[model samples]
Target: MEIAPGIYSMTQRKGAYVHAFLLDDGDGLTLVDTLYDTDAHRVLAELDQIGKSVSDIKHIVMTHCHRSHLGGLALLKERSGAPVYAHQWEADLIAGERKQQPVAWRPYAPVRVWPLQIALNLGVARHPPATVDHFVQEGDQVGPLRVVACPGHSPGHLSFWWEQRRLLIAGDAICTWPSLMLGWRGFTLNPTQHRASVRRLAEFDSQILCVGHGEPLASDAAQAIRAALPSLDR
Candidate 1:
């Protein structure tokens, strides 16, 4: 699952539920997302698959405040003694001090929406709070990558930009397949801002794209995103 020289892609069900990533920065391992608390074991297993151990993970970075993305964060942090990095806007949310806002319900939606709502209400995907050791902003260097402010999915939503590798860890900002979709509108806080973010991300001179819930792109990542941006309105 080594997508790049030092990058390993560890996904559960091809990220249908969630996906976490590991980067061997030569010094230590850096984890991208935590998936879910229940999936922490899977993370460990995946780490083993990549010839890395739990203790090797030096840091955990969150893309946004959604539960599915940060579910196993607390457990991972506790086990590895790694500091968690998040955006300042949602740092409190990750710290257990602030509660997440529920998705806005649209009347008479499709059948799929109901289950999504039920899960949220039941806190099914919610993760135990993990402390944020650092808050990142656009242009800040984070573990060999730069932060790209892609808010709209969440107040402090971010996408990691690895300029040297030309890889973009888009968080929920963009997803491939089923044709370049934006974050679920029901779950997103602002459609206008989301659209803007996606458009902005498409402009990156990237060759690979990684997301929280879809297959990763090996090449032509920016072209795919440009093609997919139009689908945002659909």
Candidate 2:
């Protein structure tokens, strides 16, 4: 779906949860958060939905190195030849130099659902190891995008800013699939940082929220996030 003028959000099931997004910066197609390799072709299909193709991808940015996000890297790189960019801390993880980080369990998780979310992330949220070509830090400018460091989901988790569109490309930093909510507690490394990340993201006051899952919030997006912050961990 079109999140704003030049941005789009696409969801491919990695069983039950986890998501990826695609951004068009008026120059070429840039993919953010690619689902598992199992869903690799889905990118080609999704691109086709917009009358684009794999070769059109000029750069691929993985929000973090989680397997769920890296799953499609190999094939996408093979086909598109676009450089994969990620945070410096996540570079090794993406390159298969380190083991994936495990989610921490928390009792007061914002969402109190049953084993469904767990089953999906553990059993289905997986992808092959891949390499990264670029390592980015906070305040980096990528085409029309501005890299915003919003960690805690992962040590180097990032969200992108489309200044002109007033849109936030929220990675696992926030999700809106079920409802306006913080990142799933289990997957987040630090609830405090995650909450802080949300707060930092809120400062942008973006009008469109292109989140990690569910549908994108097309309007008053920043208010929606700030509105939810009070309930998160203090």
TM-score of each: 0.89, 0.88
Per-model CA lDDT versus the true structure: 0.78, 0.76
lDDT: which candidate is best?
A: 1
Worst 10 residues of 2 by lDDT: 105-114
Model 2 ranges with Cα > 4 A deviation? 106-126
Superposed Cα RMSD, model 1: 2.4
- Output the TM-score of candidate 1: 0.89
lDDT of 1 by residue, 1-234 (tens): 788888877666522446678887788888898876544887888788878888998878889877677767888989999988889998998887877776766622233445655566566565687789999998887786788999888879999988888989999776543335666666677778888988888888999888887678888998878876767777
Task: Give the range where candidate 1 is weakest over 10 consecutive residues by summed lDDT.
Answer: 107-116
